[model samples]
Target: MKIGYIRVSTAEQNTIRQEILLRDLGVDEIYIDKASGKSTDRPELKRMMEYVRYGDTVIVESISRFARNTKDLLELVDKLRQKEVEFVSKKEAIDTTTPTGVFMLTIFGAVAQLEREYILQRQNEGIAIAKSQGRYKGRKPIEHPDLKSTVVQWRAGEITATAAMKRLDMKPSTFYRKVKKF
Candidate 1:
């Protein structure tokens, strides 16, 4: 079986391009999510992982779509390898079916990880300087009228967290942060 996974950070984004590419590669199933790939709890991705079986091939448009960062990517790949599954990243020209793919993947993973770390380090430094200068006021709190209702529904088990998230149009992190301090 050939499976595909695609991710984007926002609801306004579309997965059609990646889908078309995966379809051309003969992917039989495609799992998609519109969450910031920075986290591991994406529903569709988790479902897809649960469904994969030995000998199945997982295809992704690129390394970032497959995982949020190198750590997650390597962890997922290791899991798939343990299950005797293969992973192919079309854009990166990586295919786990070959020895050279393994070597390239290691190099690529290291570089990608370094890049991410450097970006995060710079961001943290900037934020710290801004905060020290009293210029780092965060985003204004959401002012939606139904936020309370949504939180009630979510806490009451009347609606799934995902449903509440969509209704609020907030990322999981933002939603939870608001809920906790609201």
Candidate 2:
């Protein structure tokens, strides 16, 4: 069986392109996760890992889509190898069925991780330059119509912090930070 794995960083991102590519490649099964590839904590990824059996081929669009770092990429491939599964990356033209392909996969994985780091470094530099030019500001503060009333209730112990946060539709960090500012 040819099993495809697809990932997108956020829920808003679309997986249609990857899906089409996998489908075109005649994949028997596909597991998709609309979550960052920064970690292997994704539900679909875990499920796919468990679902794959011996003699199966695991296919991905690219090494980066499978894992953001070389360590993770290598670890995942190693796990697949242990399970007697073959690994293939369409974009990188990598196939772990041969010695040369395994070597190329490692090289490509390292390159992908380096590329990601470079991108982050460039973005941070651009943000710094924009800040110095007074063109960059942090994210705008979130406002709620009943923020004051909710805070008051929270402070008076009328509601739990979690409840107050839920009512305000704010994350714990955001709720605490905003409450502190008040």
TM-score of every prediction relative to native? 0.70, 0.95
List, residue by residue over 1-182, the lDDT tens digit for candidate 2. 99999999999999999999999999999999999888999999999999999999999999999999999999999999999999999999999999999999999999999999999999999999999999999898899999999999999999999999999999999999999877
Q: Give a tens-digit lDDT track for model 1, residues 10-121.
A: 9999888998999999999999999987777899988988899999999999887777577788888888898889999888899988999977877787776777778889
Query: Residue 115 in model 1: shift from native, Å?
Result: 2.2
lDDT of 1: 0.87
- Return the lDDT, model 1, position 45: 85
Model 1 stretches with alpha carbons more than 4 Å out: 124-136, 144-182
Error of 1 at 58 (Å): 0.2
lDDT, each prediction: 0.87, 0.96
